[model samples]
Target chain A: MMLKKVVVCGVGLIGGSFALALKAAGAVGEVVGLGRTQASLAAAQQRGVIDRIASDWADALHDADLVFLAMPVGQVASVLVSMAPYLSSTTVITDGGSTKVDVALAARQALGAQCAQFVPGHPIAGAEKSGVAAARADLFYQKRVVLTPLAENTEAHIALVEHVWQACGAEVSRLDAEDHDRVFAAVSHLPHFLAFALVHEFAQRADSAQLFGFAAGGFRDFTRIASSHPEMWRDICLANRSALLVELDAYMVELMRARVLLAGADAEGLQAMFDTARTRRDAWLDGLTPPGE
Target chain B: MMLKKVVVCGVGLIGGSFALALKAAGAVGEVVGLGRTQASLAAAQQRGVIDRIASDWADALHDADLVFLAMPVGQVASVLVSMAPYLSSTTVITDGGSTKVDVALAARQALGAQCAQFVPGHPIAGAEKSGVAAARADLFYQKRVVLTPLAENTEAHIALVEHVWQACGAEVSRLDAEDHDRVFAAVSHLPHFLAFALVHEFAQRADSAQLFGFAAGGFRDFTRIASSHPEMWRDICLANRSALLVELDAYMVELMRARVLLAGADAEGLQAMFDTARTRRDAWLDGLTPPGE
Candidate 1:
């Protein structure tokens, strides 16, 4: 299915990559960029990520087949409110936010009855670098794009979002908005928070320089996610606070168990836990698809 | 200052890599291997990592200018006791154990007066894959090798060990045994335990497959260290229990701080903490030397 005109609200990594992928796949007729800054929109257009820059939401959404809100979670509510008047009844909408429930709530409050056309999605692909300049057409190829379909979403609207993601070479999956937030809160958000906490712990130490100087490969890999955008992570942690708190509490229990094993000098127990973790991680990695497949 | 004979006890990744590096540098004449299994020693010899497999400590230490105990921290005490009778005052002995304080204590208790000949050291270089087959001549090149010299250790013996690591192209640093344990407990051991705990937590869940399925780059990198050798980590953690427990407590406090911020929905505080972490990690990466330099 071809989209006549796709309006991307934020022309950064996710939005720009989506526009580029749809354009490359010959799935979209025209990609129009709308963002906070004209300079960023102009940059996206110059990079061929967008056909043109829209002066306003009405201009961007006029006759638009799809409108993608690809911004941080904190920005989603205001953007949804701003575009609600311009949103055409015929136009379907989706998002690339990290958290789903909050975005769904915002869409419901802003779009009201028109919320039936909105699909909340999160593309599980990212790099240490971001922004329009880091965008690529193949970013989502073989990647997972999870669509948390709200009860209000029509079958046709959901299918349209799924078809567009498939055209971008993504394997699309569906889940309830609450389930999506809870799953990610466990797998993604908790790890990010742990990493950030570790780095913050080290940085605040009196002998931080000495500790960092001694850190090697294990430390580097374990804390790599700690270098993620602070504002984005803050928004995600706050948006999914309840589920994340549950995960954090559960993880603390696990850590406390580990601590007991260590404090008591139980080599057998510690080895058992480590063995399980290593075996599970190795198996997971083995089952993963090779890159660029 | 070239070594006439160097006996490597384990002939695994660390031992084999040391032998290969010394050979590559033309700094040693003969590399002898000694281990629990003849099969592993034979494999190391076949890979050209060792000149021959030693029949016993008597044979391995005979005329050996250097002896390297590259076995796990758990085995260091028994190995030191086994080799003490064969060790010569002229031979400078060192180790590649992760923990230093315990190893130094083991040397002192096992070797008695001969403890002066032993230097406790840790080469902070490793890969997820281990064993002799994974060894490389350049594994320690441009890496950090920290030595914790005992008061019983002669300056000459310490220098000899340091010189050999330098010959292997590693930058050597010195710290007190207590300080070495504390530093690594924070930087390396804590991170490994956290990764292991996180992965184990996910694996034990009823919906683990679903959680692992949705885990992306952040989770992958954050838990990469979870795939490390269980036995090795078990030995390290048990050997460095005191310091590791202290680190764990400090980290728990940090996690609690983050938890409070999330639970309170304190976006500004959470963002500030994340900002500090990212800024510090970025600075650390920026200051790090590029690979293969």
Candidate 2:
């Protein structure tokens, strides 16, 4: 198979790693990197994520057969709009955004007929660390990469995007944009919110001020997500507010029950609450209970 | 200083690691292992954790200058009562129980005047993997091992317990038994409950029924504690039910507030909720936050 010329915007962990994965798979002939920081672009270039460094966004996009939006989720719409005027008819565009519906709609509004060439994609993969320094060539291997295509999605464009992900060793799944948003809101967003809320609650206590040195392995594991980039999570929570609200309601119902059981000295009730959760989690996590519980 | 003879009852992660650490630090002349399981006793014996594996508990208690109960929280009281007849008048008995108040009170009831020699200890260090195989000489390095010295605690016994943990490379902090219960309940128990509960809730979803194939690094880190021994956590929740209840109640308050904000589409409230937590965690984690947030 002939290699496509691919340009990756943003040289951070997600983008840089994707760029390396494509290079490792030999799916791209030449990779071009665009970044706001000269140091990051230089670092990515030195690491061979890109065959050549681009001086500007135009330099990166001009001859590219495929363009990847690996920047922040908030930056996706604006960058897509800016790239449309220069995009070739043969060029295909895709994004590595966490939230898809907003990005997909933004592409429809901004690119119009060009939306047919844009495949809205999100690879549910990343490390806790950031920056190009942490990039790995096999980062996306065996990970799930979801694409949300609109009614106007061209067959050729969808196949091209799937080919790109498959070459990167990802298992591709196609789903409606709205369903993608709701599922992720439950699986991802609500978890992040709970992590932040729980950590904030602990940090407020007088006991935390003095005796928190006693918090061991479990405490650290559960609250590690609370230490994520605030601006990123803030944007996500705001963008996915509707679906996240539903999950928050469901969770509160359970929390309230636990509260009641505890207050009533209902050891039986507490045991019931704990046992149900314990048995279910144990079964699910051990692969005995099928997913979606 | 001559090496102290220490008898560690229950040879597993905590006790076995404690023995390795003491031996490494040249803090012990002889270490004795007392356990109900023959395999664990054999492992501890082979690993040099105990100079001898006790087949009879009373005979093991005969020669020890100090006794450390490293058994499960639920079994601490019964063990104390069983060992009371074997304890020497001059020996100090301390336990490494996670929950302190009940164990301290139990020591008082079971040991009577001998209770003054008993100091309740909890070292805030562990790995998800347990058993003698997980034991390490540096397991407690730079970690806190809190000694909850009750009003019944004597100066000599407390000092000896503090010296033991310090020799194991732990920074020792002293607290009242009840306060120790309250603080750990918030930091450790509540987080474990939530992880178990969330996993159970998600298990019921049809989408999750397929497989948890899309789990990311964040999900793994957050739920790593969910894989802990269920019996251990069950005993903890049961032993420290009151304090765990208080923390769970406090947590639901925040969870509800978050739900309301998400439901009302109050983006500002949502941002503030996340921001307060983000800023608070960042500041506290980065070691820049004021004493109270």
Q: Could you say which candidate leads in TM-score?
A: 1
Instruction: Categorize the docking of model 1.
Output: high
Candidate No. with top DockQ: 1
Model 1 misplaced regions, further than 4 Å: A290-293, B290-293
TM-score of the B chain in each candidate versus the native B chain: 0.97, 0.94
| DockQ values, each candidate | 0.90, 0.41
- Listed in order, each prediction's TM-score against the native is 0.97, 0.86
Summarize candidate 1's per-residue lDDT along A166-220 as a digit string, tens digits.
9999999988889899999998999989999999999998999999888898898
- The local distance difference test score of model 1 is 0.93
lDDT leader: 1
